[model samples]
Target: MLSAGPTPKVPLDSWEFVITTETGAEYRWSWSELMALPQETPRVDIHCVTRWSKLGTTWQGVSLDTLLDGIDTDAAYVLAHSYGGYTTNLPLDDLRGGRAWVAHTFEGGDLPAEHGGPARLLVPHLYFWKSAKWVRGLRLLSADQPGFWETAGYHDYGDPWREQRYQGD
Candidate 1:
């Protein structure tokens, strides 16, 4: 479940992105890289399949609009590649809205590693799974694909508004 919150906005100026490998190697992302692509800071509400919802969340990250700025998206969908081969696919449109973000900072602090630090995909409009934690990269695809949980019976499109959770929801 997601956490319920009045959702406070905290200054994220000092939050530096940190990447830790399974072998314990740590790398810090430079501001140039963080801002290499166009980024958007949005005040959004998050809904987790776990059922906790946190409102008024302030997040900062590269927006799909910014990332696809000069490149042609050859695929009809995208694969959210994360640590441990965790991934989720979504139609191009789903990633377009200003609603989606690759958030690097949360609640005025660098996101904790336990909470997908370094970077995480924040799909505020969908169930949290759609927002892959510990995100690394995004792969464009020609067709829709399912990820680990999806193959295990979770809904393919985790839309929070529709309350899509388990199969046949």
Candidate 2:
């Protein structure tokens, strides 16, 4: 498990997830509301930019597709924001079509805070850093915006398989 900062202990009652479109429209889901949404247990493989790979890990959460349903946006990119102020950007398309989820459980148990409990974005197809642990919201943007790691010289699009770990990799 890895995080850019200390774990945030979010109270379930105050925890909420929001989706902000480029037009500033906001859609929100509280903890109870989010738990009521359809949930799926995805068994996936995750690779980190630091050169470690974990296969067939199981996670439970609502799919990004489900959360994005009915959201009206013409944006081409998305910036995932976490509770601790960590952010990561990705093409909007990369988050749709069953590619991602906001997971709250891992290995059949509630995710530990050390592991981004409450919830975290799961984008297994990309390097684990793109997962944005402790995720709280996604901001839809019309243009590309580099997030924390990207701005620190990490590859803007970190794909472990392609060895896209550093800016010039």
C-alpha TM-scores of all predictions? 0.77, 0.98
Off-target runs (Cα >4 Å) in candidate 1 are: 1-31
lDDT of each: 0.69, 0.93
> Could you give candidate 1's per-residue lDDT for residues 42-157 as a string of tens digits?
88888878889889988778786665554544567767766556777766678785767778888878776667766788888888888877676666667777876787888888
> Per-residue alpha-carbon lDDT of model 2 for 23-123, expressed as tens digits?
99999999999999999999999998878899999999999999999999999999999998999999999999998999999999998888888899999
Clashes counted in candidate 1 amount to 7
Clash pairs (backbone) in predicted model 2:
none
Indicate the TM-score of model 1. 0.77
Cα RMSD, model 1: 7.7
Clashing pairs in 1: 1-50, 1-51, 1-52, 2-51, 2-52, 2-53, 3-52
What candidate 2 gets wrong by more than 4 Å, as runs, is none
